[model samples]
Target: MTDHIGTAPVRDGLHGGGRRRELAAATVGSVVESFDWNLYAVLAPYFAADLFGHGKGGVNGVLAAYATFAVGFVARPVGSYLIGRLSDTRGRRLALSLGMAVIAVASLGLAALPGQRSIGVWAAVLAVVVRVVQGLAFGGEAPSVAAYVTETAPPRHRFAFSSVSYGGIILGSLLSFGVLTALIRTLGKSGLENGGWRWGFLVAALLGLGAVWVRRAAPESEEFHRARARQRPGGRPPFLRTLREHRRSVFTVFLNTLGGTVGYYFALTYLPQYAAAYHVIDKETAASFMTVVLAVVLVTMLLTGAAADRFGLLPVARIGFWLPVPAVPVLLAGLRGGWLSFQLVAVLLGMLVATVLGTLNVFTGLLFPTEVRAVGLGVVNAATIAAFGGSFPLLAEWLGDHHRLGLIPFYVTVCTAGPAVGLLTAMRVPSFAAAVQEAEAGIQRTPGSA
Candidate 1:
């Protein structure tokens, strides 16, 4: 069940408390990455009019902003593939650092850009370009962090430890929400609407630099070093050949992520996007509810991680995948005329999604040997996210506009259950499951494992 090309297990060269340091570096990258990416979503409503349409924050402006958001997703696959190759070739530390720097540049560009009123159509053009750059940079962020962080874990606690990276995501979301909420109180909605949102972008840019600085001091994973050592002059085959050998594993990653990606994006964006486009919820209330959900989800993620560590990844992840099916219908039902109850529904959905996010790296990280783990997760996960998660808001909005809102639940249901189906299918494929199981065993035997 090991790598067909004769790979050795990854034995790290750690001394002292290197594992904690690596986790911190990866966690910071996750925070900055989440801050930079989610900033656009959190503040898009306030800034959409200024940068997007005819100086009015209406449906069209929101649509235009979301379109730019989707455009950013388009660049993700390319970014992940390139960064995956870079990480596999150079080092995870280098790749993670590079992505953070790119995000910083994009954040600064967004912070300083002129709005449509000031620069006309060129403002829109610049926004799109900046988002695309940001998306491409962010494409590398997750896989690199996942590979770096999870590889440092003991096999026994890998799931719980994996939560650290995603917990960073929730913390970053909280930071974005907290920052914007403070600005709203200080400057008022009128101020944010009048261009105060730019400050958030500036802060995000600064944070990105901080993440890069932290990453610079972090050590590279010993697992990566072992993989590199295995690649003697004549030892490894062509990269494509290596990929072909593990194509089924890559496909498993894709299926596993299909619904998981969409569910995460949908849970995070739906209420806000709906609030923006239709005005069903006010900005402040939306922010407050999201903050609450994020806090709950953060704690829930850590607990789920611990659960997976105890019950096994597949079992815990199954709960995440299936819970969304029954929950989405109720959530969509609440959206119809029950504003007071929507917060409860949203929290439920958020917790379900967090379960997936929390244990995801364990599945992806162990699906391949150390040599291709980053790229194996990177390319497939990015492609699935871009295709489903990126395009979701536009699709949902279009459906709502057409009065076909009833269909939305069906989509969400299917996506939430996709991973379960994928896992079931993979169980029948001896090679794919065996590969993951094989890596799982090796991880337990890793340097720091209990």
Candidate 2:
């Protein structure tokens, strides 16, 4: 059956009506999680003075603040390992609910905390503790959602189905941007600098209420339920053993994620900042540009998800990957022009990146079996995201600082090529197709097959 948004068939033998609910649940969950995470980077610049010791040492203060942000990222893999095991054995609902709860509490903690001026270094210390919780919660959240969606959908439409989950990321980003823009308008620069940013965290905390409702309402996937019923103690393979047996798949996922994740942050998140930092535009204009770009990304994400269902994940992913090689130069040139050029590039090339990134979980989840799917997806994503995602902002800052910004293109090239090559190599591995078939055959053998 087709989803309301598109003509793609439901996969994993999910009932047409039930599949809709599951998709909605996963999509909403993804959006809530992404909104909280993405907002931190964009909002950090305004609040750094109070939180990160901005005047204490000039540039070093900002670096220390960003370092704290990076520290949260460092905690994700640990979150993934702990949460993935829980989702794999206990339940997706429990794992996701708990993670979201932790984020909500941390956000509230941040909202209520005093700034360094009022509370001394203890304020920063408290902020770091909250950030660690946020990091751990987000780390487990994505992989579990991916695994749940992959197993829940019908096989034929799995990729397309998975694409829907990514829509939440774009949706959340746009929402966060909208909220930030509103707060800036209402409070102005001084007001925002003082405490308006704290309101953003409060808004984030409120989302947990919606997340809880969705989690409670959505039923567990029937496939997952069956897997639990047939549980065999000690029969489940160790994560390392399963990962070793499927090392090639792990490598392929890492390569695929490395390019897509880095490219995504560059185009959607980092580019506008680049424009502002280079004096091409002012802060408001840069934020506005990114907000518009994210809006475009949101629309494209939904369309890409639908397309992935129709064409299969790999083919659509390949098209998204290769399209950027030509567009990157154009984007760079456009950025050199003015606002219109940047917007044009944002709409065109932004869509290209979203196509692949929007459908990443669908493809990644299919690469592993149930035994290690969560752990495998988590590790690969964590590694690629940590290396690529964290590095881009730092690299951009470094290049700009040195006036060697032209090197940015080479950086993009390497990021794009690494994944493209891995994907191409993955296609040739005999086990890729065989594993997919085996998975399908297992489903077919199930009683009533849903």
Candidate 3:
């Protein structure tokens, strides 16, 4: 059968060696992006006193650092618009390379920055600036990589390939926590606070540079090349056209993302900080727990992705969404009890969230056509994550201060419900992926096409 004008020909289940090379590059690029973005979370406790000057250095100091962490996400939406547009207009390979370059620079800046003792508040200011740049880079990196992986994979294996993108994030978290655990074991608390944390940022910088080189050598996706070739001489910007034509798709993707974002941040990323703040566990213990949680999540994610390929995206997504609603309250109750319970429940929660993330990348990629897929996914992802995911740490901190910590599980439950409902509504539309494919075909057949 002949291929569609702007689409690559579908292949069998097995991928060629060249396609495998593209996957490896995208995976490494994603790992570097995740490491750069999340490294601050692991080190925040040690640096909070020096950077933010929170009195006697307790929960308040950690909260201040987390606040700075949250501020970084504020730039994500703007970055998504600018960099996602670049991917649409230029090429995925260029966007991936450029984002990694920015990440490397920002990671190096963080490693070299002086504390408040040297530059006073400027140290904090500089930290936030580097974080913003990192956020911007990540905003571009995720969608382009996801789109590239999805568009390049064979129809029978798209979910399996796309799932590897999220696996990079799990591995990045594991690496960050593993290094922190080892540092605490070797250097002890005071030593880490004094200077040891900088090494982690330095490692991230080196990894980011390596990923930039890898992505630079990777080939551009055939789908992107075909779509670019068919662009009209003068037309509306892809972002604007996406808004005008694909509003429902954009909204569906946003709703689909809400549950996974809230669950992952609250359950995995912020849990360590919360444990340290409440004195439920030492920093080293928290790091150890997260290391284990990440290992479980990585395995679960790969399995869930394969399940999506075998069963269906919507079925896997629905299971992921609803299972967590009841499980969260029970886990939170366990968390309030003690450290052992916290570790066990946290691992279970991570696995549940991984199932959602497993299929989400492919589901969102199929929502838009090749021409606007990157920007559409990026804009929706950045907005929802900034609004809900990034703010969860700060919000939980405030709630804990107000003696309302028990409400967090209920908040997560509500967020999970949105995706379950949104996805069911989305499936009601007949052949949603087919509709996107047909739209791309229509664009290719437009009059005066190249």
Candidate 4:
């Protein structure tokens, strides 16, 4: 509620308790938004064919819907550039509020959309369009939240605070699995496809309003205010210029991001579908396992955050880096074996991957300076997410249908290795620290530097 737009306020409550509180508020809002966005993926298989199908091949139509699901990731970089620019020039708070508003509206719109029986192909088109809007909002959300947390928290706790941004993700997963479990219990199978899915979206729409309340309570970050106060000449760096100069940092981030995306999507997004397809688990059982796994994921997320604080980002990232190399193969083996063992192994794999991703929330937040943090996070995340996260489901679906299911672990291994190598190399680079210093320097030299 207090505005310190043109000057750095005295390091009083706002810089201390007030700032952390506001950052926490922002993180809470982000978690709610993520819950809304991700809830759809869990329910996608049920709704996609039912509503989006062309009345042709039922399951095939559903598969097409999943493919369309990947299309949203394509817009992430575009959204990152557009939204990230707006956040930098305008303000992180404004950018986030606008993004959340857009997502809220999109969720409500999707809730109201007509199904295939009612509108035919247009329904599918409408769904895709709304999803693209959601993707755009998401593209901005992660970076904006990460930047806000890092800037607002005390320097010593930067990694700890930033981890909260991804904690929101785990929170979302928890809410999603919990909500779906309850819905399935009440609605039963037919109710699920016929009316339950729509209600699920409605639940997301309602949760979105919580973001508005949280953002309202959020106080802006000191770093942003500081940058604005300096008001120095020629302080702004073109996005591309920043990238060109810090090419290695950017690559490291991309790779770091890649590892998280592949591991996460493979475990969270594709696993349920894979389990159901192979009859390894029934729909309800799969949902239950997912819910339980997510609970474990939530716990690991917090531990990883604390770990980052105690140990630092590099070491934590390294653990995440190599832990999954062996874990991936074991994960697939469990899935292929049987339902009971697969569920147990699935949870274990989820925990391992969760640790890797949990580490990322802090490290990636620290990667860029406040000036372009949103976009930097956005670009790297967008690229890696699009390449790995978005394509994961579709690829898994294809591989499964073609009887190439054995390749799943190999695919995960390849993707996981990309970021592992990138991060390890980045640890050795001289410019990693310099990059952060340069970014901060640019901000201090900017107009009205705080």
Task: Give the best candidate by lDDT.
Answer: 3
lDDT, candidate 1, 1-450, per-residue tens: 344321223433334366667778988888888788778877877898899865344457767887888889899988987898899789999999999999999999999999888999899899999999988888888888878865666546667777877789888987888888888989999999899999999999999998889889898876677679878766645557766877766777787788777777777766665544445666577776788888888899889888766655566766776777777777766675566456776788888888778877666666666777777678778888888888887787678777776687788888888777767766655644665465456555663442
Candidate numbers, best lDDT first, in rank order: 3, 1, 2, 4
List the candidate 4 regions with Cα displacement exceeding 4 Å: 1-17, 54-59, 231-234, 338-340, 428-431, 434-450
Residue 337 displacement (Å), model 4: 3.3
Report the lDDT of model 2 for residue 226. 62
In model 3, the worst 10-residue window by lDDT is 1-10
User: Total clashes, candidate 3?
Assistant: 0
Full-model lDDT, candidate 1:
0.77
Give the Cα error of residue 53 in candidate 4, in Å.
1.7
Q: Give the alpha-carbon lDDT of every model.
A: 0.77, 0.73, 0.78, 0.71
Better of 2 and 4 by TM-score: 2
Q: Report the alpha-carbon TM-score of model 2 versus the true structure.
A: 0.89
Expressed as tens digits, the lDDT of each residue in 1-450 for candidate 2 is 112111123244445667777787788878888788777777777777778776443365555666667777777888888898888788877887888888888888888989888988888788788888888888888888887787776665566567678778878888877888888889987888888899998998899667867777676755566666677888777878877877877888888887887787787777777767656777677676677888778778777866655544456667776777767766776676664565676677678778777767766776666656677788777767766775577667667767888888777867776566766766654545554444346445653332
Q: Estimate each model's TM-score.
A: 0.89, 0.89, 0.91, 0.88
lDDT per residue for candidate 4 within 1-450, as digits (tens), equals 122111123442225557666666667766776687668777786787666774464358667777767888887788888888887667878878878888788888878988878888888898989888988887887777766765665544444555566777877877887888888889976787885788877877777776766686677766787666765666878888878866776887787778778877777766776777777877678776787887788788768866655555556767777888887786677677763465777788778777776656545655566667778677877877877888787888788778887787887887777667877667554534443344345434653322
Please give the distance, in angstroms, between residue 165's alpha carbon in candidate 2 and its true position after superposition: 0.8
